[model samples]
Target: MEFINIALSNLPVTPENNQQPSEGMQTGLDLKEKLSEKMKMAVEHDFFAGIYYLQGKYGHTYRELSTSRNLLQQIYREILEYYIDGTWVLLESAAPIILRTQDAKSKHFLQLGFRDLESSRLFHQRGSNIGKKLYTNQINFYKQGIKRVRRARKYGVLAILESRTPVEEKKEYQYVSYDEVRNPSITEDVKEYDRVLNKMIGLISRQLVDATIQSSTRGYPLELDLIEMHQDNFGAIIPDHPHLLNRFLSEVETAKFHERQKLPDRSRPSR
Candidate 1:
C-alpha cells in the first residue's frame, strides 16, 4: 500500500519533459521485462506459502487445483483492474484507478490481491529428482521446492497471461507497443514497477530467511559448498537448469581455482 502511494506521487505530469522516443521505449521494455520476472518470483513464493496455509486450513488439494484452473475466468477482470488501479494507470489517467470491486467473496478480487497465497496447492505429489547430481550427500528436497515454484508459476501465468496492462480503454489504446513510444509518463511510471518488484523481493527474502531459521533448513549444510565439491569431484553438470547460463558457476570456479593455485604443490610430498 505504501509502495502504491509513493509511486503515484512520483510520476511525471507530462511526457514533453521526458526523454525522446527511442530511449524511453528501451527503458520501458527493460522495466517491463524486469518487473514481470520479479512478479513471477513473488507470485511463486506466494503460492508456495499459500499451500502451507491451505494445508493448515485442511483445504482440499484438488479444490485448489480447480481454483487455479478457473482463475482464467477472471483474467480480463484482473486486466481491467491492473490498468485502472495504481501508479501504472497514471500513464494516461490524470487520476489513479478507483477500485470499486473489493468483495472478499468475489474470486476475481481474491486472485488479484492475494494471488500468491490463494493459488494452487503446493507439492501435489513428489516430483522427479532433477537436482540429485547438483548435490553430493542425501538428495535434498530443495528440488521439491523448486518444482513447487515451477508449478506455481505455471498456475499464475495460466491465470494471468500478460504482465502488462493497458494504458487506456479505447481500441487503439488496448495495446501500446514499446515501438509506438509516445509516452514519457511511461518512463516515470515504470520506476514504480521497479520499486514494486524490489518490495516483493524484499518481502520474499525476509520470509525465506525466517522460514530457514524456523525449519530444518537451519541445520542443513550450505548447498553452495556441496555444489562446489560435486563440481570438483564429478566435473560440472552440463546444463543445470537455473544456472543454464553458468555465470555464477564460472565465477565460483574461477575463485576456487585461483585459491588452489595459491597453495603449494603437495604432490612433492617431502620438501
Candidate 2:
C-alpha cells in the first residue's frame, strides 16, 4: 500500500487575550426600566392604598404593601399584558388581604402621625408628654423611612451610574478616597460609605468570577466591571446552578490544552 500524505490546514486558534467576563448577563437597562415602572406602580398603589387603609378598607390594604413577591407579580402582569396580546392574567394571591390591609394601613397612619409630630408642641400620644411621644414613635418612623429611602436611592443610582458609564470609564468609580480637609463629619461619613461600598464591590467580584468560570464553555467573556457595578444589592452570591462553575473551569482548561496543541511542532516540521 502506498503511503498517502494529507495536509491539515485552518486549524483552530485561541486568542491570547481572552477578556474578563461580564459581571451580569442582564444589564441594568432592563432592571432600571422595570424599576421605573415599578416605582410608578408602587407610588400609585401606596397612594390609593394609604387612603383606603385610612378609611379602614382592610381588604385593600393587603394589596398595596410593596413586598418583593407582590412587586414581582405586578411586573409579571405588566410583562404579560405587553408581550402576550395585552391580556391581563390573575396573579396568585399570597396572604389574606383583610388582615394585612388593616396592619399596613395602621402603619401608614403612623408615618403621617410621625411627620406631624415633628412640628407639634403637644406630646404626640399624651396631653402632657407630647414632646416625648414625638421624640419616640414619630422620630422612629422618620428615621426608618429615611434609611429605607436612602437604600432604595442607592440601588437606583448605582444601577444608572453603571448602565450609562462606559466600561473604560469604570476605573474612575473604583475605590477612591473622599477625605475632605474641612469637615470631620463628612470625612467619617465618606469613610463609612467606602467601607460598605467596598464590601458591595467584593460581592460583585465573586459573582463575576463565578459567572466567568461558568460561561467559559460557552466561549463568552462576561463584562466583569459592569457586573461588579450592576449586580442586585442583595444578589451578589454566586448562583446555585449545579456544576456550572466546575463545567466552566473544565472548559477553560480544555481550551488551554487545545491551544497548546495548536502550536507548530518544530521537531516534526517538514517531516
Candidate 3:
C-alpha cells in the first residue's frame, strides 16, 4: 500500500499570527516528517522481504522482515509518545492515516510470514530427500511463526481501534494556533478512509472467529486458547452479525466456565 503523504505545508496559519511558525512548532513538524519517512522505510523493507522470500534467499528475507517489524514497533512507540505529549497536534490530519497504515502493514506482514512458512513446510513434506532434523526445525519455525503472527495481529487491532477513537487536544497545545484545511474533498477523503477501516475491522474480527473455530475443530487447544485471549482484547468491535455475535458470546461463557472449573473450591475448607 502506498503511504498517504500528508501536506503539512497546507495547514492554514491563524490570521492573528500570520508569521512563520515558532522554532518549537517547526521542530515538531520536522519530527513528524521524520516519522513519516521512517514509516515509508518500513513499508519498503516489507516489500523487499517478500521479494527475497520468493527468491528463496532466506537470510535476506529474515533480515529485511526483522528490520521492518522493528521499525514499525519503534514508530508505534513514538506515535504514542507524541499523543501523550500533545505533539500530535502538529501531525494535523495525518495522525489517523499513520495509525491505520501501521496497522494494515502489520497485518499484511503477518499473513505473508505465515504463508511463506506454510509453503515451505508443504514443499519439504513433498520431498523424500529432506532430512528429518531439517524437517523438525521447519516445524518448530512454523509453530513459532504462528505465535508471532497472532501476537502481531492482536497489536494491529488495538492500533487500528486507537485510530478510530478521537484524540482530545491538550491544554498546552492550545497556544499553537492552526486550522486543518476545511476542503470538502479532504472531508470526503477522511470519511472514505474511515468507512474502509471499519470494514477492515469487521473482516479481521470474523477472521479471528474463523481461526478460533478451526483451531478448536483441529484439536489445537493451545492455538485456540491463544486466539481466545487475543479476541477478548477487542471483542467490543466485533461485527454486528447476530449469529456471529451470539456464537462469540457463547464461546466466552464456555471459556469462563472452564476457568471456573480449574479454580480451587474456596467454599470448602483446605485439605
Please, what is the TM-score per model? 0.20, 0.24, 0.28
List where candidate 3 sits over 4 angstroms from the true fold.
Answer: 1-19, 87-271
lDDT of each residue in 1-271, candidate 3, tens digit only: 1111111111112224466754434444565566656666666667667767888989979887777656654444343332222211212222345445564543454444344434433433333243433433433433333333333434443333334333432223244434433332243445533553454456457552122211122122112222222432222222321222223223333343245337676997879
Candidate 2 Cα lDDT to native: 0.32
Runs in model 1 deviating more than 4 A are 1-139, 161-245, 252-271
- Sort by lDDT, best first: 3, 2, 1
Q: Is candidate 1 or candidate 3 better by lDDT?
A: 3
Model 1 scores worst on lDDT over the 10 consecutive residues at: 208-217
Kindly list the per-residue Cα lDDT of model 1 for residues 156-196, writing each as its tens digit.
22222112222252235476678676553444445533443
On TM-score, the stronger of 2 and 3 is: 3
For model 2, the superposed segments whose C-alpha errors exceed 4 Å read 1-26, 66-69, 72-222, 226-271
Candidate 1 lDDT at 269 equals 72
Maximum-TM-score candidate: 3
RMSD of 3: 25.4
